[model samples]
Target: MLSTNSTAVAEFQRKSAQAQAALEKVRGRGTAGNGATSAMVDAGGRLRDLTFAPTAAKWGDRIPALVLKASRAAEQDAIAQVQKITKPLTDDPRLRQTLAETKSLLSAEEPGKRRPRPKAEESEDAYFRNFSPHDPR
Candidate 1:
């Protein structure tokens, strides 16, 4: 019979290998304003590739801004990929912890990444409330 520690170790190793394989398959893609520039990153948040439209080359000094935009987009993409990959592992506590760590690492460093507030017409309560007109029997 295997010792408890050995069994645990074996399980951990198996899960780790599975995680690595899942990560290899996960990828993110980001695009700048109107696709002037774009970037792709792996689940580990490492840039895999980048592309720029012809108009992007016109901005010499603005390259930094464009790159930052692309990087932010790439980070968003990675988070989405991580979310999808973690959904199936949600039942495993250890795997959930790993996914939390991965999410922290993949968060965007740039400002204004937060989604804009919804307009007045988009209120959730407004949509969910029942509208009853006056009725006389």
Candidate 2:
């Protein structure tokens, strides 16, 4: 019985190391602004590159927004790959605590994966309604 448990633990460790190595190789590519803006990020959500195509000239005033959009897209891509790497490990009942620890190491949330926010568009009583349409409060 002891040997069986020990072997299982060793196998789990091997798979964990393999997954970590695979995660290190992940490079997420994303583009936005009609493909004029591009970004790449590593599995840890660090920006690796940013570039703008010649077509970006038409977006002179909006270039900053394009950059932000592209970066977020790249980060989301990295996060997705990280999730894929960790999925099998997380499914193991004995590894639940490790999953929580892994969540802390991630720099960005997976876009569109967060819980729905309370609707700020749903106004309060007319007398109490504020002017901000986007405010979560």
Candidate 3:
């Protein structure tokens, strides 16, 4: 049992270090308005830099929108990079199984599928009361 605990702790530390290293290497940049605006985001999706071209003023009221677009693109790029870096760890069977189990426990319904509401004749309290802690069905 002691060895198992130590091994788990060591694995956690190793993965944590790897994740930190991957994050440190992340650098995402995005541009919008035909290079009129650009944004750079770090691994944590924090804006690191923003710049606008001399003609950016020509965008008028649309300048904010352009900046937002650039920012979003930069964030997406950062997320993609992080995913790439963590692919190996995420692909591990143990991690996948844990994620699957957690998702199942949190949400019984699949994505984009809504559970049907109880009939109008049934009171909301009664519907909830019917749920048993031991039985999820």
lDDT of each: 0.72, 0.81, 0.84
lDDT of 1 by residue, 43-120 (tens): 878888888898887777887787788977897888887777666545565555555665766774556476566777
User: How many residue pairs clash per model?
Assistant: 0, 0, 0
Ranking by TM-score: 2, 3, 1
Measured by TM-score, how close is model 3 to the native structure? 0.59
What TM-score, computed on C-alpha atoms, does each candidate reach? 0.51, 0.65, 0.59
Candidate 3 C-alpha lDDT tens digits along 1-137: 44654565567568879888889979899999998999999999999999999989999999999999999999999999999887767666655555566677779778899777777746766878897888977
Q: Residue 64 error for model 3, in Å? A: 0.3
Give residue 14's error in model 1 in angstroms: 7.3
Q: Provide the lowest-lDDT 10-residue window in model 3.
A: 1-10
Q: What is candidate 2's lDDT per residue for 1-137, written digit by digit as tens?
A: 44654665676798899998999899988898999999999998888999999999999999999989999999998989888898887777545544445565573677668655556634444426555767766
Judged by TM-score relative to the true structure, which candidate is superior, 1 or 3?
3
**Candidate 1 off by > 4 Å:** 1-19, 92-137
Evaluation by lDDT, superior candidate among 1 and 3: 3
